[model samples]
Target: MAFSPEKSNFRSPLKGPPSPSWNDLLLKNKKALNHVLFTMHLQSRSNKQTPSSSPSPQIRKSLDFTLPSLVSDPISLLSDQILLSILSKLPDSQRNCNSLVSKRWLNLQGRLVRSIKLLDWDFLVSGRLFVRFPNLIHVDLVNGSLISLGECGCF
Candidate 1:
């Protein structure tokens, strides 16, 4: 399989099976063998994407570098299913931002809202959060100050 420049030099950070040693013999020219194995890995990954799973060229082009960096926050970098697991534990402010980040996040937020308490004595949302989550059942106002509850149907 043809290798792209990005794939030609990839190296697994692991030292174990599923990555057999036969793929890179110690006696061989170590660097060249490593490059060959890396190429194969990339080829396999590319081939694994079925037509339905592959992004269109437009989508591939529209994705910017920041998208990956934003997602690479280690906790969030976990799989989407895993990210969904901890959404409620995140600060309310973060949940709002994550909700805006992508469709995946928005979908997660929809599921997560059912389980979220939405109000913390220490972190209250007087604006959009309150407006957006109208079903918020209870909020902690202890040791908190009042601010106008903007367009969220709050008093």
Candidate 2:
């Protein structure tokens, strides 16, 4: 058989200088690349590390090498039931903060806060406790003996 490079199944890599298109792309996106690097550096500096939080699949796609806390968010990928379940573990203050993240989250947070703490029975009766917390299952009173509002209208 004759030595024929064209007939061979295998092909050698370019021995000549690399194409300038790659260089053009690099130059054009110099600022974007820097922004991506800086964003990644800040994210790395923070201690909270998770596969989703890392430069993983979703983040990479969203970042496209420029990802942040997501324009939509990967956590939204979770079912609301699971998301609410996860949110339920957070403290009241934390939950309150989380509620401000979005309307859907606010509704979930509201529904998950099944307990209410009141100064006394007066505030409980004065307020539409049931209407306020449709999912409320428990009430914590600060001072019980001194005064008691027998029955709230909302009940």
Candidate 3:
């Protein structure tokens, strides 16, 4: 029997590097990596012991109040449901100021706001210029502000 390397040992030249599929490895290790990252973030946050090094200016402000009695309680901003209910009842002309307070308020899906009145020319111009809502059927403009509904492609 002749010692033939090809016959005695089977090795594919095409298999020179065993490339493990990348997605399989990532999916397997996802939970472990997330845990490590979360733990490291918490550890770094806890290691900063001084208030001077605290990241939140709001927390620092709260600590600086010398007169505890004088410090006013922060008014609870209305929840979206309450704001929506209030918005439903309030006249159309009054909605913008309250809506302007927070992005969440701004994001109250506009179908909930049926009527919009533009009392201020700037507010009307800006609303006509930018805002889009499917359900807005009526817009009353005062202060000589006018929007050409014909010019606007919106139907």
Candidate 4:
């Protein structure tokens, strides 16, 4: 007994007409298949050579070119009010370090100060204390020299 495609009642699962044997199909499209294979071989050879070859000036320039960074300062993105709110939640000891970050951070942190202990009446007289902390509601002048406050003319 021998197996044969023609003698069997098997139908192709594919949608098109039943396929012939591999030998018949290969014989029919041998020239077309050879052309396709030759083109593919040439393309693969060209691809293999490309990486070894020096790129053109235009291509080299394009490869060397870099785009500007999209990343920005995360602190700069937050609104002043939000930054102040965050600064206000910090502990008194940790709050001192926030001023060292940047001028913007210092300004934001200053706005969060509701009470300040005055060490020098000169600073208060110079008006820089009020300028730095515009939101201050309480000022502790106990540490300052008592005579300086009366002479400062801040009354």
Candidate 5:
């Protein structure tokens, strides 16, 4: 009886118990393990991607690892409130610049801005304050040159 692997390279005419070759079993196990690992990777990725907002930069980096058309599910990314909080933490100049990154960002900017100060009102885009920060809870008007009972239209 040849029990060593090196001696079982050839088929024998005598057959007793059918023993599956080690190579064949290993190949099957390898494929199954690969599939299970891939499934685990996907599950873990989804769990980690649902963070408050750090994934913004991470996702951009992830896109470099995948094809442009193979993006992950957008809905599972993050909650709107968390994302808004993250945006609120950014500097005014940065947040305003990034507001044009996507439609989502544009909408988020409006809801995230809790307050703002207007100095030279005329220097701003007309109606831009109201349009961009419609949900702003508090706003300070500092244009000292124009202040009247009926002329505070910009405010």
Candidate 6:
């Protein structure tokens, strides 16, 4: 076979016009690409708005019964001791807010409070202090000024 450049399958490097750049190709198809993307977005939104298929009545009933038990407060499942330990780790500033969460949490937070400054002697006399903070190891009474004289000037 004769070697001929004109009939050869391969073309010379400089023979043809240069290939289009990515930017040019993308710009030319920009409107088409946008339409495709907009349709895809609408499809995704529709998919989210509606379920693909409805469950059977039996399956729905089963889910309805099981869902409540599954969704029950997970925090309530923790034991008092575990909750106390978790509460104890919180900083003093946060303890007050934690107590406000519930009566149980208030009691747990009180147990975690090891020390208290007594501002009112009536609290002690009424036994309300001990009731609120059962585990208090340190009680400050100096600030309460429990030694003030009565109207009769008696101790």
Among all candidates shown, the one with the greatest lDDT: 6
lDDT scores in order: 0.56, 0.65, 0.55, 0.69, 0.65, 0.72
For TM-score, candidate 1 versus 5, the one ahead is 5
In the range 17-109, model 4's lDDT, one tens digit per residue, is 865854585458756644544454445446777666855778645532321122133235456886787778678788889788999888878
Better of 2 and 3 by lDDT: 2
Compose the digit string of candidate 6's lDDT tens values, residues 1-155: 78998777886678896678645754587567455444544454456664656556786557544543453454554569978877776678887887998999999988888899998888889999999999999999987755656734887
Tens-place lDDT per residue, model 2, 1-155, is 68898778664476555547534854577667557555645465455666555655565555554444442443554568977887887778888898999888887887886777766565567766565566988877765425444554443
Model 6 stretches astray by more than 4 angstroms: 1-70, 146-155
- Model 3 earns a TM-score of 0.26
Give lDDT: candidate 3, residue 22: 38
Best by TM-score: 6
For candidate 1, report its TM-score.
Answer: 0.28
Colliding pairs, model 6: none
Tens-digit lDDT track of model 5 for 2-116: 5797766666678766777534654567556444444545565667775664446777566444532443443224557866877787789988997887888888988777787
Across residues 1-155, which tens digit of lDDT does each residue of candidate 1 receive?
78698757565668444543532543258555444444544455468888688767776555432243333332333455766766776778878887987776786776666434433433455465554444565554543544447735787
2 versus 6: better lDDT goes to: 6
Q: What is the lDDT of residue 134 in candidate 5?
A: 74
**Predicted structure 5: lDDT:** 0.65
Expressed as tens digits, the lDDT of each residue in 11-130 for candidate 3 is 689879665653464447866644444454445555776756665767545543432333232122234575577566655565666567666656564646656675557655566423
Task: Estimate TM-scores for all models.
Answer: 0.28, 0.35, 0.26, 0.48, 0.35, 0.50
Error of 5 at 9 (Å): 60
* lDDT (Cα, 0-100) at 23 in candidate 6: 54
Q: State each candidate's clash count.
A: 1, 2, 0, 0, 0, 0
